[model samples]
Target: MEIVMSGIAKAFGTNQVLRDVSITLKEGEVHALMGENGAGKSTLMNILTGIHKADAGTITIDGVERTFPNPREAELNGVAFIHQELNIWPNLTLLENLYLMRPKRNKFGMLDKKAMLAEAENTCRELGIELPLTTEAGLCSVGHQQMTEILRILMLDAKVVIMDEPTAALTERETATLFKMMRKMKARGVAIVYISHRMEEVFSECDKITVMRDGHTIITKPTSEISVDEVVRHMVGRSIDEFYPARTTTPGEVVMSVDNLKPEGFDNDISFSLRKGEILGVAGLMGAGRTEIMRAIFGVDKHNGGTVTVNGSVLNCKKPEDAIKAGIAFITENRKSEGLILDFSIGSNITLPNLDDICPSHVLDSGKLNSFADELSKKLGVKTQSIHEPASSLSGGNQQKVVIAKWVGKKPSIIIMDEPTRGIDIGAKRDIYDLMNELTNDGVSIIMVSSELPEVLGMSDRVMVIHEGRVAGILDRSDATPESIMTLATGGQ
Candidate 1:
């Protein structure tokens, strides 16, 4: 299949998202779509899949000009879009979630569970994917949910597949499996539109690259002809000399400590300590209980046996509010569902947690609320025209900024950041890194749980490896290498 989108343009009211953008995807090619948040990459894809109409553009698929009425039609026509967000019914079993929209029926008009199971098993076997079909999707880990979505696209047998940050939640092994499947699909003459913010994956896997910036297509060329530095320059219009900002401040005395912490579903007790003005990065595989430990610390998940101490005071936190009052904040991994409300305005989301501080006199102070939100938004470098715009209006990176802004307003002594830069662009990631440096300089402590090993090594003053719900080993920044971290993460001695 060959898809050529030329002169594409789209606008939402006064905001023009995509203007004069073009790209070409050939059969059996893995074409990378690289851009910063709000750079119109998703908007262009939406237009192609018919979720949004292009005001001025020509879409030619397989040498014939055509337009899809909706995403369903596009999928039926062999163009599948695996969105960045997981589209799973938490209450439904994996098998039911897989065949939710279209189910096979028996001759008597009954659901054919046998046939569905047989087909699903065959596909999973082919892809070397192992998942419980009977388990509710909510009970499964985020990596499993991500694999399910990818499996759905593979089962579709689409001629053109658009994958947006497909490996964001996947482990190293799962990512290898996904890349293997992509290779197989390519051999079968399927064209894949791969979208990710990970430079290493793009340069290693993609055949061609298309860079977009500020609603315009900057350049499109073969991957072999371009370097990561050049691609970043095109995407952000400047070369980033430093990827992760260096941490200059030395860690102070311990500000928080967890001893003998044992959350539900964990057999092994966990323990750790965070120093003032320090970044304690938690690193491990997808299901290594990194996020679980963070949740337990923040009081979102109760620990059956543990002690959490802050400022030399032993504390028992029963809920999130208790932790919040104890000067702790948590930035969850799933930003869309947990971090910010899509329907709410950006300003409202930022000021929601600090309402008491803004309206101290027991009165609604609109001016104070607006000013507080605006100040934080600007401080975090959120690229939005107005704080009054709905959070859904901003791109993924900007929404993450709002999430950080929301938590930072609380002036918490300890902050837990989970997957702080999962799907953001290079420029936005640098912004967050710089922000972390600033926060730590101000004597604030951070516990960052991340799946990205490079991020863990780059920003952490101390890297704590977790394995099977237990602390494996904590290494100093100078001593922490990729091999050392992985060894400890995989239950090494």
Candidate 2:
């Protein structure tokens, strides 16, 4: 089956999200869509999957023009879209969720439960996914839930499968498995449209690449015809030098120290110390307590036992406000729910945590708020028409910038970033890496939690590998390799 989208245009009120965009997917070819945050990639995928209607366009599937009013219509036509966010029912079992809408029936009109369960088991086995069929979806890790979604798509017998950031929440081994499955799908003549910010994955798995920018298609070419830098240049419309800036200052005296920290779900005891001007990386497999440790340190989650010392002074933190007042900033891993207020303007969102500084005489001060947001946005290079625009209107990368700006506005001495570059394109990723360098140079201590091996190894001066709620080992930059880190992270030590 082949898919051709021609002259597509879509608009919402005054915002034109997509403009005359054209894309083609040949049978058995994996097409990669590349773009920066807010480049209309999601909108285009929505239109293709029947979530939204195109103002002007023709969707030709196998040489037949079709207008799908909803996802069911598209599903009936063998089109399946696996969104970045999982849509599975968490309370249900994996087998139940897979056969939710489609049930096997006998001649007497009774549901065939045995047949559905057998089919689900077969599908999981075929994909090389090890999941308990009876286990609740909510009880599994993020990576396992993602695998369940992929299995659902396979069971549907989809001719055209669209995957959006499929590996964003996966570990290295799980990602490898997915790539193998993608190759298998390609061999079966399934047209796959893969959307990802990871250039390495795009080059490794995709056969054709399509770049989109400012609501329009830039170019569609073979993956082998271009380099990563050239693809980035096309996506961002400019050349970037030095993605991660080199550190300037040597690590000074220890600024913060934690001893015997234990939080719920994350067991055992953890201890670490961060020196002034040092960027410490925390690496682990999914559900290995990296996020739990950070959340506990920031006072977002309650700690059963721990002692935190800042600058040789014991700090009492009972809540997030206490942590904030103690000069600590936390950037959450889930950007959508934990980081930004979508309905608020960029200025409001940026100054939300530090509203007191922007107000005077017990009244809101619009001038000070706008000035603060303007200064931070300019420094962070956030691409936006105006600060008055809603945060939801910005792209994923810009929204992340707003989150970082909000915390940086308070001038926190210690910053903790969890998966800072997740789901963002390479161009924006470079900017974030540069920002980390600038902060460390200014004597701001940073604690970063990441799942990507290259990013963990490339950016951090020290890496801490955690396995099953414990620090397996700590490695210096000189000794941190994928093989070495994975060995510790998987309990090989």
Candidate 3:
């Protein structure tokens, strides 16, 4: 199948998202769509998937002009979109989930479980996947769940597959497996649209690359002809050095301390101290207990034994409210689910956690609330039509900013950021790093938990390596090399 989108344009109110963007995909080719957040990549895909109508554009598939008014129509037309959020029921088995999307029935019209199971088994075998068909889909790993989504699409006879960051949450082994699956699909003459922020994956897996910036198509070229730096320049309109902001704050006296912190999974004791005006990064691989330690400290998870001290005051935090009242804030890992209330307006979500700031008289002052939210939105450079708009209306990077804005408004003494820049664009990441630098410069200590090694190494005054839920070692900024951090993270001496 060959898909061509020409002169695509989109808008929301007065905000123009995409302007004259075009892309082409050939049969049996893996094409990468690269762009920063709010650059209209999602908007273009949404239009193609029939979620949104383009203000102006043309879509042609297999030499036939097509218009799909809805996602079902798009799917029926052999175009499938695998969103970042996998669509599957946790309560159903893998086979059941696959059948739910594309049901197979015998001549009598009764549900054909045997036929469905046989087809699923055959499909898995063909893909070289060792998935458990009878096991609950939710019980499987994220990589497996992703493969199940693909199988569901394939069962629908989809010819063009659009995957948005399919490997974002997968482990290295799982990523390799996903790559193998992509290769298999490509070999089957499938036209795959791969969108991701990981440069290495794009360079390795994609045959063609399309760069978009500020709602316009910057360039489209063979992946081999362009370099990573050149692609980044097109995406952000600048070089990579500007991606990570330089730290300007120096470490001071200890402001927060965790002694002998024991969570359920780790084999050894966890201890760390954060000095004032410091950014202490926690680095480790998946399942490294980095997030668990932060959760325990923030009172979301109970610790069997430990002492948490903030500014020489012992904290007996038994709940999130207790932690917040004690001058500690946490930006959780999953921002969409845990951080923001999608149905609420931008102003409402920002002030939900800091109501006291605007409701000192036991009632919210509407003017003050909106004013505060507006200021935060401006400070974070969140692009939106209005603060009254729902949080869901904003882009992923802007939504993340709202999450940070919520906690930063509280003026907490210490902030714990878990994967602060995950799933965001490069420009937003630079802004987040700058915000951290600003906060620490104001004596607001920070504890950052991240899987990205470069982020930990670049923004940290000191890095604490966690292995098996235990503190492997802490290295000063001068001594924290990627090799050393990995060694400690792997439980080396």
TM-score of each: 0.98, 0.92, 0.88
Q: Which is better, 1 or 2, measured by lDDT? A: 1
- Candidate 1, 61-150: lDDT as tens digits: 989999999999999999999999898999998998899878989999999999998999988988898988889999999899989988
Model 1 Cα shift for residue 183 (angstroms): 0.5
The collision pairs in model 2 are none
- CA lDDT of 34 in candidate 3? 92
The collision pairs in model 1 are none
Using TM-score, give the best candidate's number.
1
Stretches > 4 Å off in candidate 2: 88-100, 103-122, 131-140
For model 3 the TM-score comes to 0.88
What local distance difference test score does each model get?
A: 0.92, 0.88, 0.87
The 10 consecutive residues of candidate 2 with the worst lDDT sum are 240-249
Better of 2 and 3 by TM-score: 2
